[model samples]
Target chain A: MALSHDEVLHLAKLSKLTLSSEEVLHFADQLTPVVDYFRELNEIDTSNVPETSQTTGLVDVLRTDEVDASWVLSQEEALSQALKTHNGYFVVPAIFTRTS
Target chain B: MNIPLSISEVQNDLVQKKYSCVNLVEHYLSEINTQNKTLNAFLTVTDEYAYTKAKELDRVITDNPHAIKEFPLLGMVVSIKDIYLTKGIRTTAASKVLESFVPQYSSTVVERLESAGAIIIGKTNCDAWAHGASGENSDFGATKNPWNTEFVPGGSSSGSAVSVASGLSFASMGTDTGGSIRLPASFTNVVGFKPTYGVVPRYGVISMASSLDSMGHFTKTVEDSEKIFAVTRGVDGRDSTVVNHSYKAVSPTQKFRIGMPKEYFAKGLSPEIEQKVRAAAQEFEKMGIELVEVSLPHTKYAISVYYIVQPAEVSSNLGRFDGIRFGNNRDSFGEEAKRRIMLGTYVLSSGYYDAYYGKAMKVRSLVIKDFDDAFSSVDAILAPVSPSLPFKIGEKSDDPLQMYLADIYTVAANLAGIPGLALPAGFSESGLPIGFQLLGKRFSEPTLFELGKKYQAVTDWHTKKPS
Candidate 1:
């Protein structure tokens, strides 16, 4: 269950995080025991036990489709915390490029 | 009027016109100004806003005495943990990611508290993103235990506990994902109540372990905790997980059968904490309440399951913090945050999902079942809040697993989605406060509160000040 160096780097990428090389070594060392701890669950007989996504038994609790205007934040308010914004939309690194 | 007043005392004083709301607030701010530097309890002090609100409320109190009934929390001051968003107030969640980010909208609970006439005095410090049990996880700096500044304040509700313990605020709103409120409350000798999941709206608080988080508060007394709980509990459309039903208070009598989990008293629990908690359990027995010994066989697996599930949820929830849309880029996340995210990503990764996350979820059901079985026979369960008393600063900083184990007795409540109340049990031999927790069935806060009131009646531990 010990996470390899490359595996730790891959996890950081998957988590949308960038770890310094030092962090990789540290996390790799720390996370191994934590992962090994998870192995304890395997000893329990969970063959037919259902997975619990939420402790509270609520499921698919949908509200009315209409918006409550009073509580809704304006576009400007919503974009106020954005690190990069242009006009009313949040700006992000471009995800696509046209290649012929 | 005295500088430190309980919620009820403040109300009575306000009713008799002994002091204006402005005066009470000023006294509280003055205390904060003097003690906060050493306590490190607050992140931002909202002086102008607090004074303005208190002065306006004082006008209403002066104009019509009966008008106070409309605002139940009228004239009482409370602090909000930085994890809960407040409009125009900088909420760091004790992390650099949102160091200067102020939300345009306030959280649902804060709105409810304000409408009830509670003035926002300041923002308290906490573990970043409510992540660690120790206050050391905070990027701002660790909050000092008001009792002894040298010792660490139990956290991630560290500041919330410190504020109440130091007489700065009557109560503080804190989020408990995994004993964030209760653990600190134990260390500081305050009342920390984590209501059942889905009881309080989670709309404005920053998300951490979405399913595990519950919005609760720290108070000087169980009655104060109940009063605040009544105001803050309920469903808001924004947080669909909240329950729509109201909690009815039930009185405790001889018929109460409280359970003591045998596993909790086992290895790792400090001898002093176990002794104090056992003494408190004996008091309940003296009240004619039967104490039944029960076993939660899966107790050992709780910390493991929690670490897995919490990290997985944290990774997914933290995904919103991409540079463009949120406060800052992911790089700003601290070492603990990065560690959790990485652990989460590794577990939920395609091939490993079934082995780690999937298996952990199943064991989580067993942990819940252990409680369900125990609750069937007993009205509630009594256990130590933490395995040991609060340690010194930098004691567990280098070791993550050791820090995680500090929440041994507490994480089970979060995993089971039950209401857990931490109250002053007694003090350790060295004079540090030791607390025991009473956990009741989901939404059975009334039973826990009733028992807590009974316990506090016989014991003056909760009333003892740090000094």
Candidate 2:
């Protein structure tokens, strides 16, 4: 059940995080115990119990359509926290670069 | 004489004119100035706002002297946890990203407490983003346990517990996702109540885990805790999850059948805490309450189940803080919160979703069924809130697993979506405080409080003062 170094690295990359070498080593040690704990969940028999997506017994509470603008934040005030911007659009590095 | 009053004591005096709302608030303001030097409890103190509110209360009391007799906790002082929004006030959640940000709208709990006439003196410190079990995770600094400054106040509601225990305020509001409120209450020796999930609206809260995140309070006694719960418990349109019905109060059984889950006391528990829990239950027996033995085999897996379920929800709930719309200071979220977001996202991604989050939900169902079986035979379950008393400041900081283990007793209640109360059981041999929990059926808070108050009457443990 040991996690391979490549597996951990692949997981981090998919998560969009940049972990340092020191953190990798630290997480390598920490994730060992965590992975071992979850191994027990694999052994339980839950065939009789339906997998529950939510515990709330009620289905849904729908609100009627209404046009109420209370406690709303202005657009500029809200978007000001972005790290980068261009032409009033949020800017992030392209996920897949076009080969030219 | 600088005196700090409990909610009950203050309410009675206000009725007798022993002190006006203005006098009580000014006295507490001065106490904060003198005491906060050592007890790093408050994050932002609202001096002028509190004074003006007190003056207004004076006008109301004067105009209709007899007509103004309502839950006069109206004039009482309260502390707010940093995790809630405090419109036009600095609420950092102890994270550096929102250090200078003032939320445009206050959290519903904050707005509700104000309308009730309670003066909010300050917002207290907490673990950044309410992610860690210990206060060591705060971006600002760790809060010191009031009983012994050398030790840490258990968190992420560290300051809320300290302020109530050290007499800085009559009571304080806190959010408990897992053990946030209970752990600190246990460490600081105060009463912490986590009402049944959805009893208090989560609107405007900086949520950690939506389904499991519960908004609750901490106070000097079980009575004050109940009063606060009554004031804030109701439906709010602002929060989609808040329940719409008022629960009728249940008087806990005179011959209450208590459950002592052998699984809880099986292993890894401190002897001192074990003895106190057993002693507290024996006190219940003397009071003619029933004590029954119960088993919850699935209890051992709660921590594993919680870590997985919570982080998965956190992965979704915290998506708003992408260095864009929310947390303005992109780099200021503490390392712990960043680490969790990274870990949570990894588990919930396409490749590993079934292996982690899906399986955890299945296990959560088993945990809830275990509580359902145990509650059928007992009015409530009694167990030690923490395995032991408060540890030294750096004791569990480096090893995250040890810190996570401190939440074992408290997390199960959250997973089961029931109410749990942490009461001061007794003190450790070294004179530190230890706590035992009284967990009850869903919406059975009054049952737990009445039972806890009955125990407090016979034993003076709740009254012991910390130097």
Candidate maximizing lDDT: 1
Say which candidate scores most in TM-score.
Answer: 1
> Candidate 2, what DockQ?
0.40
Span of 10 residues, lowest total lDDT, candidate 2 chain B: B64-73
Tens-digit lDDT track of model 1 for B220-334 = 8888898888899888888999987766657433479999999999988999999999999999999988999998999999999999999999999988887776687888999
Q: What is the clash tally of candidate 2?
A: 0
Q: What's the distance in Å from true for residue B226, model 1?
A: 0.4
- Model 2 lDDT per residue over A1-100, tens place: 6656665677567554567777677776776676676777777776575554555565677776775677566666555555677777777656798899
TM-scores for every candidate against the unseen true structure? 0.97, 0.93
lDDT of 2 by residue, B1-467 (tens): 44433566676676677888888777877878988888888889999888888888877776766523464467768999998898878888888878776777788888888877788999999988888777879888898988899898899999888988887887899989889999999898888989898779999889898888889999877877887887787887878777866676764445678999998897889999999889989999998878888988888888888888887777676666656544563345566775676567756878777877777777788888888999998989998898878999999888777888888888988888889999888788787888889998888887898887887778877676677
Over 4 Å off, model 1: A97-100, B1-5, B251-254
- List, for all models, the DockQ compared with the true complex: 0.80, 0.40
